[model samples]
Target: MTAVEFDAPAGLTGRGAGVPLSRWAAQWGMAVLRLLRSTLFVGIPVVLIATIITYGLGALTDTNPAAQVLGETATPADIDRMNHYFGLDRPLVVQYLSWLGHALTGDLGRSYYTTLPVTDSISQALPVNLSITLLAVLIAVLLGGALGIGAALSGGGWFDRGVTLLCSAASTVPPFVIGIGLIVLFSVTVPILPSGGYVPFSEDPGRWLRFAILPAIALAVEGAVAIARQLRTSLVGELRENYVTGADVRGLTKLRVVFGHALRNAAGPAITVLGYSIPQIIGAMVVAEAVFNLPGLGKLSLDAAGKGDIPVIQGVLVTMIGLVVVSNLLVNAALLRLTPHARRQQP
Candidate 1:
């Protein structure tokens, strides 16, 4: 080839490669910054709102503040001293502001029930709650997805009707009722499983699984049923889409046509349902935890609320609100990423 032609082709190829590289670099940079904004910027306002509501309610209430700092025999002076010590004497707004300031810095204050720092207790307990929640979500997604896909493929036939009816029956029952039923069935009649109560997995792996299995299953039923129905509907919709028809006409196997070609497209609507399900799942976990006596966040929050433990209650609320907010943001981001049309419209 001539030197001129060679140089021209090389230049053109290099420029083409550079364009995509520059575009990708820009996209990557934007994604990183967006994540940071999502985590720190967006999360802060939500936490503040939670703080305002939590501390605001705490101030207006006449609940025992943080496990009675004053002794039974303490005089008025001692009570005053105690109030001053815990900043209970301060104005409501001022106290909230102080709490807000400390909270923003990750200082969740002291717990009345535990005499331990609120931050420490939450830090220890959070992993447990988070682990349970995650496991439950995992279970829901897998089993729910399977049941949903199977039902959709069966198309209201025997398998489909049975699965759908089973989920309906399960969902109709409350978590506590289900937990009690399972406990009675397994622990009373069958004597196969422990009745209730948590054991550290580290202490005894077998007991941990045995105890957690029923609670996790009980907690998952609602989400599982909901997700499954949504998935079945979504899959049906996907199957109706023209693209799915085109795929089938192209001679793809039924399994490939259904799963490989259609399932991903089916996931878009299901994702939305999953997004909404987050809070509901957490609420369900409360009863499930109570029934099982699992020391997860649900039980902790209940204990906090029952005793009017402001610090613990605030801590739990903030954590859950933060989780939900972040989850929602993530869902939005994922949806936008998955559906290019949405991202293109956003600056």
Candidate 2:
């Protein structure tokens, strides 16, 4: 009698402890490359088009950039000279190309009001805003997922009904209104958390969290509610599927049927919804930042608009477009991993 075992091919063999890590790594690497290709193919044209559109709108405005730069009292000759100096006299396409080139090189132009480089302002403010938005989004997704799974597993009891009602009501409330309510509750009554302000996380993470909490709540609640509702629906539908019935019929344990099978199947649509919510999250952060008086990208954009600081505004919008593009790319790559059909298509 003889015994022999076939071994995996070297490349297919897992690199460490027989864990199949190499296989996993290969899948993730392909996903990353796909993300890069999508970003390059789609993101670049979107930015260019946005630049052209924004620049054109700004150029066509009745408000004079020269007047904004100098003063209303500047003479006609002064205005002409100022316009020429700023290259507003050049063809619109030339101006856009010049600005785009500078932007690509990290020269987003000087703020007409601040005289500081717009790119520098964006770099400084963007991280803070990103921190808040990212935190809020994390909170929303985690809490929403928990609530949904809990409700789904509850099997339509009081808990499920109550959760559904709560999510519905919360989703209908505007984020600003929620922010105000949170402020009144936490700041005025409790007087615990800071109302709103920016603190560098490096300097004091505690202070940063305290300052960020209220705004994050306001920004997170509505999204959380919507996510909860969506996930609950998806989970419920997944539970009703024939595969789930077969799992139960085959005597799989309750936990395995519910989580291992049902939740796994429900995740794809929930992820798709979450991916599409990134822009809305950014928009909500703008309002939340303004309400909280945080010195974030949103606040910078708001103030720049108020002062007619077109360059800064342009920088902010461009930054937002980049954020959305990158977010979409990451989301799509992640989707490929979680979705069987998508992975099949990729290979």
Candidate 3:
């Protein structure tokens, strides 16, 4: 008898193989393209519809843009002249098309109140809102994840009961109410942090953090409670699955079985909870920003709406819609990375 030997293919033999690298590259490229296509498919129609509604709102209202710009003392002739200058005399379809074109090109028009470009106001205010929101989200994720994991590991003990009770109580309280309480406790009682007012990070990072902490905490409370509840439930369920038993039987350490296996499996619903919380956080910012005296987009929109500053209002709303869309895109990308099922189902 003759013994025969065969060599394995290069791709099967090593991580350095060209075929595997090319296959990985192709998969990543396809995933990115699909993500982009999905974003555009959803974003374009949403923006178009939102813009149409926002533009039509001005026409529906009794308030005239010209009157808003020119003030109460302006004569009818003056208002008419101003309207013509703004091309408001044109057909609705024409006006909308023109505005859409300019918006697409990054021109949101001048504010009727300030006579400054709407983009300028949004640009100045967007950072403050983003800072507060991002900080709040970070705080929520970290604190919530910790509490949830701890409670799950506690196995229906005192810690789990306490966390559940805390979440229930916290969920009932509004962000503004929490903001006021934080102000009393941290700002007034201890006198360590400022009660209100935003400092730009560029001007002073320390002061910016000082001013941001309270409002961020207030905004974080609701999200934290929500995440805690969701994650605890998911983790508890995951820990009971047959796979966990298999891991234990394989002699995997308790910590490894819980975190490395169970946590990852349980994270999908928690991620979804986090993603849905973002828009709620944005909405809550109106009260949070007002409470904190932060000159953010919420305040900008509120002030603009009260004064009938249509252009500014439109700009702020559209900017918010864009933010929501972007956040959802990020969430989708994160899911693709974390969830095997999502990756398998990807187009």
Candidate 4:
């Protein structure tokens, strides 16, 4: 592969020197297509395998799905009739095919536990999960990014040492442990914040904050540490660059040059890492939600699994996989924006 350069086009050239707008656009388009293609090739099979494993686990562990639906003490005839109606009597491959076909059409069938449509269950659960994850990510990124930049600017001062020590400890502690600590501190010791639970923000914003604070912090801690450490490294390296020094020598205030100029260049790789790390937030939410007793997708999936609610379980798995795929796409595009210099130019 050749590293070629072309003259910048119009308004885009000024943002970064000699970045050819046309070439950048083409490269970005190709990156998107490649990401989509690769994701489909990998994601589809993984989803199918996950479905097979989930369904198989249920079949092995759950002696009777029909009994769960129709009542455990129901007569054999009713159980048989229920099984027949639910197509639980069919072979594994046949049942999987039927389910897959319906899934392709955006129909995940009905829940075995509640007998409600699977989409309805997801609709009810998805918002809670989204709220927790989004809030956590926002808090982590802002606070962590600030700490990282501050540490870099201060070099080896007390501030830098403090950030290093704090982020190190926070990173070492797992999210579930953090949740437990928060519960112990806030709920038991101080008696200020609610230990854990969910209240819809639409219904009562005040109560919702009380419930949301601990969980969000617990969920954000590890991620914040993650972003801070990675970003601190990037910023430390950027601060010593010629351009940064030049800006500093040009009579720009220390604060202005370090933050305004140095931080932007440093942020590219940090943001790229942050983008790739978003899924960790989602993964941590499972532990956070369960620990907090929140009725989010994590808890819902656990309940569905225990009850052999195959539809809901499958729906949740697929939804999570879709989120990961979409997050990766967004992150890739964002990475391009952040590190525009990384874009290749074709001769």
Candidate 5:
């Protein structure tokens, strides 16, 4: 009989565990540092370049010049005052630096058309836009995801075929066209809902939902169809995996196996698609706002364009860019959190 003994390393009781723990902590710290550096190094420069371009374009397209073209009501002195007021009289580089500095300090300047603080304008309008967009997205996600689940489960039966057809039809129609059609049907002929304008949720909280319902539906249709298609594809892929087959073999209820197990696992990629959809939804805001005549940021931006109001245009552009950048960053962060594989990667 032979006796076998295993030798342990000195100072290694629980030390190996501490090593991996420390390594993980250091990795997370480096990730945070890289994020901050990227924001400062890459994002700052992009913001600077965007500011310069926007400011230059603002100066070039000012109401002063266009007003001059239209035979100005204001005298040369008044025009000069206006230019100075907007910092348009400065050298382009200086103007950019000054604007960038103000921006970093939370100063977005005034609306050229309204002569009101840009911040005030945004504060007044953003809520309405945000409300409408959020409602639309919620509707899209619920309806789309359910339809996708049904379609995937049916696997090309009549119900799946019908859903696919509906989505295809929806994807073909432009949001603006949808808005107009809904307005004609519901607002003009049926007279069931308001065609345009916003009623603050506080003013008549009940009316707010009805007022937004039509436009929200119109706005949501395209997004819903797109989301549904993506979800269905992902669900189908997930269903074919071995784990799902094993679940099916275990005598689990079909609904539980599909919804609880397969569908949830498939949701990761679908959520990523939904994240990218945020910007597209924002882009739709412009058309939806104009068509609905909603008192929202989109309408404000468009009015600025019509008047060639440089300050307002610049403010709107900066706000939209900020939204897009923030949305992308947040989506990436959420994805990284949800996907464990992403967080463990080398920088």
Candidate 6:
């Protein structure tokens, strides 16, 4: 064969030369569209059902919102007027529809106690939760990834045994329990980090970090342990696969074969675990926030529920559900991108 013919076949086999840019772009676009469609398919019904239940529970409660709003001295006529103003005198369905419509427009109604808009309350509290949650996730991923990778690479050695034991111990403890211990050690005994409270990052980054670190670590321990265990299992399985042996036989360095190839293949399940961890982290935040006294949504929801502050409660529930849905969507998108099998299964 001529040189041109020989080189042309090689060029045809090269990924960059074989696939047109337009084809690559089209594939990514299709993947994104599929992701969005699936998200909507699952998210809409979940939100609808959850909102309905929330509204129903509030309506069923014996605590009269008007009674809560007006003092004991308020007359019957005054209570009736307040109920009328709140549209509580209307049918449950009508009241729900009105609330839903307003919620869609970013008005979650005024708090029965404070008379402040629900959105305003959420806006004030959201940053604290976000700061803690994001920080916890970052710590979990970093610590878990390191431990898992190291354990897997150790091939059932002492390091692997130690990691397995540590993860098992860590998983058994609740975040709040961990938070209290952290307080005792870091806040009380050491007297270094603040025991409880939050400061906005915009005010002072140093103080914010100090306030956030302990709570973040408290929340992180469980997540890190979960991720570590999941990743270790997945990585071990991946390392035993034929492709790993083939890569090793191809004279690739052990590190590259393990990290570059095996890790990528093993990461999907770990990512899924990480995604599911968010809701659990949020749930744990209630106790963690209480222990730490951070003014996050969990604390807000708890206080609202205690006082039968329906609007605030509803807003918090809806916001949490939205967070979960968005996190799942992002996780699914990441899975589709990282795992060929996930994309191939997509219709």
TM-score for predicted model 5 compared with the true structure: 0.82
lDDT of 6 at 76: 94
Best by TM-score: 6
User: Candidate 1 overall Cα lDDT vs. reference?
Assistant: 0.72
The reply for model 3, stretches above 4 Å from the true place, is 1-34
lDDT of 4 at 28: 67
Best by lDDT: 6
Model 4: per-residue Cα lDDT over 1-347, one tens digit each: 33333332222222456557786677667766765776788778988898898778767774688887777579999998988888989998889889999999999989876778888888888888788787888888898898988888789999999999998778788889989999999999999998877898889989988888888888888778878888899888877766656665566698876666666667766777676667888888888888999988898889987777888989999888777777767776666565555444322
User: Per-candidate RMSD vs. true structure?
Assistant: 7.3, 5.6, 5.8, 4.9, 7.3, 4.5
lDDT of each: 0.72, 0.79, 0.84, 0.79, 0.74, 0.85
TM-score (C-alpha) between model 3 and the true structure: 0.88
Which residue segments of model 2 deviate by more than 4 Å?
A: 1-42, 72-81, 241-253, 345-347
Q: Can you list the residue pairs that collide in candidate 1? A: none
lDDT of 1 by residue, 1-347 (tens): 22221111111121233456766456545665675676677678877876888787877777655326544676777777666767878788888888878978988787765557787767766665666666677778888899999999998899899998898898889877878998999999999898777777678878777877887777777788888999899888777766656656666688987766577657666677777776676667777777777777777777778777788888888878777777777776665454433333435
Best-to-worst lDDT order: 6, 3, 2, 4, 5, 1
RMSD of 3: 5.8
Candidate 4: worst-modelled 10 consecutive residues by lDDT: 5-14
lDDT of 1 at 172: 86
Which residue pairs does candidate 3 place in steric collision? none
Which ten residues in a row are the worst by lDDT in model 6? Answer: 5-14
| Candidate 5 lDDT by residue in tens digits, 58-170 | 66753464344335577777777766776767787887677667877888877655568888888788888778878888888898899999999889899899999999888
